[model samples]
Target: MQRWKINLSVLWLGCFLVSAGMTMITPFLSLYLQEDLGVEGEHNIALWAGLIFASNFITSFFFQPLWGKLSDRYGRKMMLLRSGFGMSIVMVLMGFAAAPWQLLLLRMLNGVISGYIPAAVSLVSASTPKERMGFALGTVQSGSIAGTILGPLLGGLMADHFGYRPIFYITGGLLFLASTLSWIMVKEKFDKKAAALSAKTSMLGNLKKLMRIPQLPALFSVTFLIQFAMLSPMALIPLFVARLHGTSEDLAFWSGFVSAATGLSNMIAAPLLGKLSDRIGSFRILVICLLGAGIMFVPQAFASSVPELLVYRFLLGCFIGGLTPTVNSLIRRYTPDSSVSQAFGFNSSSLALGNMIGPITGGALSGLIGIEGIFIVSAASLLLTSLWTYRSLRRAGMGAEGRTG
Candidate 1:
């Protein structure tokens, strides 16, 4: 096999393991706080869970660009190994935490070291041929989506059969295994001396230079809005399911189904759309998918039953699948080869920012506008972004084929 193909295969597995490890503990975190860590009271456990969960993304939002910068000077595979090994150790220690504070601190540390996904993305993007960029990213994204969909299900079963602490050990072990495999199999032809020269400018200097490129800021906004629109309603989804179902019995099952429905379709759609992007154009597909996703959200706001919501969510996923990969491809198209890792790093930070803020904003807005209203706000945001993106690209004279500059 060719070197890029081998790297993609190994990195795909690495991305999957890390994505699964990040999400797996979520389903049982509250229980871990109450049972394993001996936290008392419903409010206290809920508060701790929210804090511990959000803390990771909060730190991640601030730190991703720094890692991205360093990765440009160093090598993407090195950054990938650092994050994989660091997160593996942190996750293992969480199993030994005697108190909630210890676990919270560890989660923050995990976030600070969390660059494996972005680094894998940078490695793949930089190495893959431009013509195949979309498909390669799409394939890698499918691995991530698959991991996300299955992680909670597996975690729940393991928590029931074994125990919470053991699940942590298992997750940590799996991360280490993925890292080890990546180290052995993934190959990067990184010219460290040249990369160091390209990255000689200070981080802020690079940020200003990249932002001055007209296409990047718009692309970055699309990244933030896509994540914001998708995640804002995630936490309140079960409540929405209950409201639509009109009963609490089997509510958890129905809610899980509705949530996974999107991912199931997304896992299927990403690669297909990515392949299509190679033949046509990524920007065109991005606009159409954004419009489609926005329209899907509208019907979801008016969904009268859980089944109706499920259908809308699944359709939305098909379009959401097209968003991220294309954005990465477009970023690569606009970035210099020497600085592509740093560009992707800033994009990752944008994604992290959306992840951190979306739920908080969603929770706050739910009280003022209601859950349905949040859906409407999300729909409106995407639709507006779609229109803005189209006009922005056209005015910049970037044709459907994209400018290689």
Candidate 2:
């Protein structure tokens, strides 16, 4: 096998481990707060869970660009290790948290060290051949997607059997092992002179340079909007499921199935779509996925049963799965090699911003417009984003076939 192929395989596993570790606590977070931390009331548990959940994104949003800049200077491998090991320690600490605030603070610290996925993406982007960028990224993405899909299920099971704290310890250990593997196995051919030269440029200078790239700013917006549209309906999914099923008894099982359905399809579709993008062009795939996902959301809003909603969500996932890998490929195409990590860092921040905003916006709007309205709003937002992306690509001189002008 080729060296890059080996690197990609190892990195794919590392991404899975890190992504799984990051989400393993999610399923039982509120339960942890109540049973372990002595928190009282559903309202209080919800409030604390929201705070804990958002804390990681809030800190990660501010820190991702900084880490990206550092990755460009120090090397992507270093950043990966920093995030992997740092997050492992934090996850372990969470198992020992004595209060809700303690857990929140630890989560914030995890965010400070939470650039592993983007770092891994940047590393692969920098290392892989330009022609194969989409397929490579798409393949790597499936690892993370699979991990995310499985993490909650595993966490819930472990929590039921071994309890929440033990799950945290297991997650932490897995992360540490992942970091060690990356340190030992993954290889990056770093150009120190180039890195030093890139390092001399200020973060503001890097931002300015990145913005000057045609279609990049718009691509970043696409990143934000894609995440926003996807996450907006997440919080209300269980409620929607319950409404459709008309029962509380099987709500958890059905809700979990609905949530995992998209990811399951995404895992299967991302690499295939990615290979197609490699042939046709990443930008073209981006447009198609965005528009297709928007249209998929429409049927979801009107689904008469949980099974119908599940089918719509699965289709949406097939399209949405292509969005990030294609966007990353496009970013790699437009960005200079020396500063690619920094560029990806900014892109990560855009994604984090979307994550932070999407749920809050969805929750707020759901109150006024209702749960079905959330899906409609999400569909409209995605459709508008697709238009924005099209115009931006045109202005950047990328043709309908995805060639740069």
Candidate 3:
């Protein structure tokens, strides 16, 4: 196999391992806190869970750019190892935690060290042929999406059988294995002198230079809005499922299905759309996916039954799946080779920013405007962002031409 193909395959597994480990604790965190850590009250357990969950993103959001800068100066491989190994250790320690505070601190530390996905992206983007970038990124993205979709189900099963602490230990062991595979298999044609020179440039200087790229800011906003809109309805999915299903006995199963439905379609659609983008234009795919996703959201808001909502969500996933790969492909096209890692790092920060805000905003919208309102707000946000992206592309003269200006 070709070197780029080899790297993509290995990194795909790495992405899946890291993403699954990160989310594997999701279904049982509250239960673990109450049972093992001795959190006394329901309110406190909920509060601790929220804090622990948000802590990772909060620290990750601020530190990703720093890691990106280092990746450019050193190599993406090193960053990947650092994140994978560091997270593995932290996850293991979480299993040993005797108190909620200890777990929270460890979770925060995990955030500070997190950058495996962005580093993998930077590594693949730097190595893949420009003509194949969209397809490669789309394929890579499917790995993470698949892991996320399966993590909760796996976690719930493992928690029921092996218990919570063993789940963490197993996840940590998987992370270690993933990192070891990358260390042995992946390769990068890095130039040390180029990295040193790039490192000499100030972070502010790099930012200023990157800001001059005509379509970069718009692309970044597209990433943020895509994440924000996609995640806004997630926190309330169970409640919404209950509303649609009434007192059905299969409510838990149906709710889990509704939650996983979008990711399932997204996993199937990402690579196909990516290949199409490689042939036609990522810009065209971006516009269509954004608009299509926005339109799909409206039907979801109005769905009268669980089946109706599931259908709409699956359709939305088909469009939404393409958004990130297209955005990453655009970012790689527009960014300088020497600074692509930093560029992706900043983009990763934007994603983390969305992760931080999306859940809070979703919860707030659910309380203030009701569950359907969250879908409407998300749809409207995506629609407006699509318009903004369209105008931005037109003004930059990249409309349909797909030139890497």
Q: The CA-based lDDT of model 2 is what?
A: 0.81
State how far residue 177 of model 2 sits from its true place (Å).
3.2
Question: Which pairs in model 1 have colliding backbones?
Answer: none
For model 1, how does the per-residue alpha-carbon lDDT over 29-122 read when each residue is reduced to its tens digit? 7667767899776445545665676678999888876886788888999999999999999989988999989988998899999989878988
Q: Considering lDDT, where higher is better, how would the candidates rank from best to worst?
A: 3, 1, 2
For candidate 2, lDDT tens digit of each residue in 86-189? Answer: 99899999889999899989989998889898889888988899998988997888788778887766665676678778888999999999899889988899
Worst 10 residues of 2 by lDDT: 41-50
Candidate 2: the clashing residue pairs are none
> lDDT of model 1 at residue 288?
91
Give the alpha-carbon lDDT of every model. Answer: 0.82, 0.81, 0.82
List TM-scores for all candidates, in order: 0.77, 0.79, 0.77
Off by over 4 Å in 3: 1-12, 26-52, 71-78, 93-104, 120-142, 159-166, 180-199, 242-256, 275-280, 302-306, 333-339, 400-405
Tens-digit lDDT string for candidate 3 (82-194):
99999989989999999988998998899999999989988999999999998999789778887888776677667767777998899999999999999999999999788
**Which candidate gets the maximum TM-score versus the true structure?**
2
